[model samples]
Target: MPDSGLEGLLRELSPQVLGALVRRYGHFDLAEDATQEALLAAAAQWPGEGLPDNPRAWLITVASRRLTDLLRAEQARRRREDTVVQWTLPEEHLAPAADRLAADSDDTLILLFLCCHPSLSPASQIALTLRAVGGLTTAEIARAFLVPESTMTRRISRAKTGIKTSGVPFGMPPEADRAARLDAVLHVLYLIFNEGYASTSGPDLVRSELSAEAIRLARIVHRLLPDDSEVTGLLALMLLTDARRPARTAPDGTPVPMSEQDRSRWNSEYIAEGVALLSEALPHGPTGQFQIQAAIAALHDEAPRAEETDWPQIEALYELLLRLSDNPVVSLNHAVAVGMARGAREGLAALEKLDDRISGDHRFHAARAHLLEMAGEGAEAVESYVEAARRATGLPHQRYLHGRAARLRES
Candidate 1:
């Protein structure tokens, strides 16, 4: 294989290989180091020898060897108890095809659990998971959080140190602790998808890469815990939302409201999958926030035209969501449905009640602006759009707000 192809293969295979390595070594730091060394070895060898049939397996073998060498060297230097023995592959385990899929799946889940270790702050867990598990660059993670690259780097480093010092186990948490940790894991995955669905601060309106990563994570979580209703709901929500990605932006990267977006452009396959998942999730007795949100998205997807939308059903779903999760965001979203179902004035009134609670959120202002525009309060609408644009973090969103305000001003 050519050098470029080999490099590409290495990049693609690194995550799985590293996950396995971490499982073997019982430390993220060691897994990362060993994976890097394996890549270097591959760079020197694969070009001359050709790509291996099983690239991931090949990388795992090389990384395992590299880890053993490092541990032996460390033991000699410190005269300390040898930790390398733990990483040594047994002769019985040498064949990569043997339990490869099962091992990889377990490793990936374990890596996620490690990233969500309770000792680190939630922000650090998200930042680290985005960087490590999602394979996002530090710059991308930093942009998502509106932080400096250096600061994100420090946060990731601290997170790694925290994991090491806290002696957090690498594999899946026990059944008792799984419920408690599930929220953090789900929240991290949600944030990843949201960043991908609508980039917070980049030139592009949609970061498909990030969105794809999030969807992949959600699917993995669903597979790992198939009976977990919230996991199923999250998968359904993401699929439903992702189905409309093609119609969510203009060719120029401007925002396209759902009412104006072309339904024909939406991915029917994803919509079907989302609908099926939602059906499966609904029978689980009680619904969670994700399930309610998925129901709302499904309501929109089921409509052939904007006027045909079941606004009352959507309003009811949002109301249920608000009940399940008393978040200001939920209330604000519910207000949009109320406005569409009842009238702009009703929506405006509902939004106004949320002002004191969600004044700092730009979306709250943007929603109010849209409602006011529909209400013919052009001046107030323009002011609200201006405020939303001022507080907006992403370039595309800010531009969209400005354009909306400018159009209203001209009218």
Candidate 2:
């Protein structure tokens, strides 16, 4: 890891380094605090001091020192005179990066298990993973989720405190528990990718860093747990989505509607890999939500043009997906597919059913606007477009929405 790009460097090593510290100290909460302090210290020092030959080792040494200080403070409060002075860990344990090849696999896996502990709620698991494993600050995670920084701060704090009480052991779990914990891990990774792929609310349409990091972590999972079908499915989904990165937006940061994106510019390499992975995942049997979603993305990628998309198959897949996931967003997408497969009126009717449930969602209004335009109700469509623009949070979405209304008005 080069010292010049410390942010990305720290993010990449966060899980591995933090894992080592937590495992050595047997204090997840304290280790996380110390790791964060180490990162902050590095941010301030490494630039002026020059990059260390072994950056990970430097971080481990720094965080371990912090952890030792914390332990000494706690021991002083207890007035334990003998143990406080005697407390010491093996020096080799503090310098984990010296033997990373030996520790990487187990340490990273254990860190993930702790971050995705079953006792934590799904929200907490995602927050903790981003903060601890993903090396995202509480503020960045808050922005990703469209929540206030204060709220996110409390949420992460609660998660850390709750886990301390949960009494989870470090390292591997029993076979039965492994499956459930890994499920949470996959969910957090997908959420991170989705935020980066299509930002929830921000000036930019995409945050490539988050998506790229998610892909890196997913690849790690795929490498270690090759037999896990959902792992393959998720990696495929992310790659397929990421393949469109080059064409997803225009030069000015406005989103290029899916129909307008140039397929020639799409990342063929990622698409090829995604296609191969999806093929492998399908044979594993029992298609999951991730598999179904990946299959849908594969269909679109398989097409040469928007007109060539298999709408009926996509509609069918969306229907199956909605059955598996009672998510309102899935229902909204199903309605979009219905419009394309059936007619604008049919799509409008389907979308209208979800209006009450998804009224506040910009996509709900945007879909209605598109359907209305297709139905030749330009005036109504213009109104819908404006409404969608008003509700839209992403700058690109807002630009596209307002542009749609402007075009409709001109016509």
Candidate 3:
């Protein structure tokens, strides 16, 4: 197999391998490290040797051996230091042979639940989920977040340590807590996708790798929980939103607002998939925020052109979303939809209601600026645009806001 194909195969299997090791061995940090080593070995050897008949089992076997070695080494170190380790390794005789590990037993979802443990911060949760479940290298995750590789390494290390200290078992959370835990998992994925789609603080408008990883992870969750309306909705939302990526930027990387983008460039496949998923999700139960958001995205995706966007429906969906979560960002977006569906003044009125909550946010200023422009208040619009530019952290966002101000000044 080619290196790329081999690489993808290894990434897909690495988490399963790690999940199996951790589930049996009860050492997450070591098991994760061992899984990475196993992946490295596969990368080195798989190109020379043909793919294994059971590639997942092959990785699990390799990783389990590596984990055992690591565990014994740690035990020896504790012995030398005259300090007893708190946990004892399970009897080797009782453990199942790696090659004979049950093919039907997958702990990947459990692994994801562990990575999103409540003890970890949101940033750490995102980093750890990408590492453990998404099978990304630490350096690759670092580059995606635009952090130094060393910093990312530390974040992941700390996240692992946090999980260990929390003493969370290597299984699903209690049935009582499972729903909340799943929400955390979904939230982490949502954050990852949002960062990729619209980087909070970066030179680039979109980090395709991060977004793609988020989508990949979302698909995994959706597959695992096919009946989960929110899971399906989240996946649908990502697909619908990412469908615009092809037309999101210009040759020079300047972001083209959706209204100005050429609709023909959007990914129809993503749109169709997203629409289908949303259709399947909406009627299942009471609508959640993700489903509502997906419904709004489907409206945008189904539109033939920007001019045909169902803004009234989108505004209604946003309103539904706001009732579910008191998110100022949602309110800001709601203001935009109001402006589009009703009028600039009405949108401005809606935005004003969020002043107390998100007045300082660059998004608020940016939206206000746009509405001001639409209201024929170019001077105020230019001021708001300049403020937004000043407050914006991402270079692309800054450039866009400044350019808006400059255009209005010239006009």
Highest TM-score: which candidate?
A: 3
Per-candidate TM-scores read 0.85, 0.83, 0.96
**How do the candidates rank by lDDT, highest first?**
3, 2, 1
Candidate 2 weakest lDDT stretch, 10 residues: 95-104
In candidate 2, clashing pairs total 0
- Which stretches of candidate 3 lie above 4 Å from their native place? 86-105
List ranges where model 2 is wrong by over 4 Å.
1-13, 33-66, 80-105, 121-123, 137-155
Decide which is better by TM-score, 1 or 3.
3
lDDT per residue (tens digit) for residues 1-411 in model 3: 877778778777777788888877778888888888888888888788877888888788788778878878898888889885644654564656544544543577888999999999999999999988998888999999999999999999999999989988887789899899999999999999999999998789999998999999999888889999999999999999999999998877778899999999999999999999999998997789899998898898888888999999999889889899988889899999999999999999988888577899898999999999999999999999999999999998888889999999999
lDDT of 1 at 179: 75
For residues 1-411, what per-residue lDDT tens digits would candidate 2 score against the true structure?
Answer: 355577878877777778887766666777888888988998888888878899888888888888878876766765655544443443535544422444435677677788888788878888888788778889988887778999999999999888778877667778888887788889888988988999878789998878987898899788878888999999999999899999999898988887889999999999999999999998996888999999999999889999999999999999999878888899999999999999999999998788466878889999999999999999999999999999998888999899999999999
Q: Relative to the unseen true structure, what is the C-alpha lDDT of residue 223 in candidate 3, on a scale of 0 to 100?
A: 84
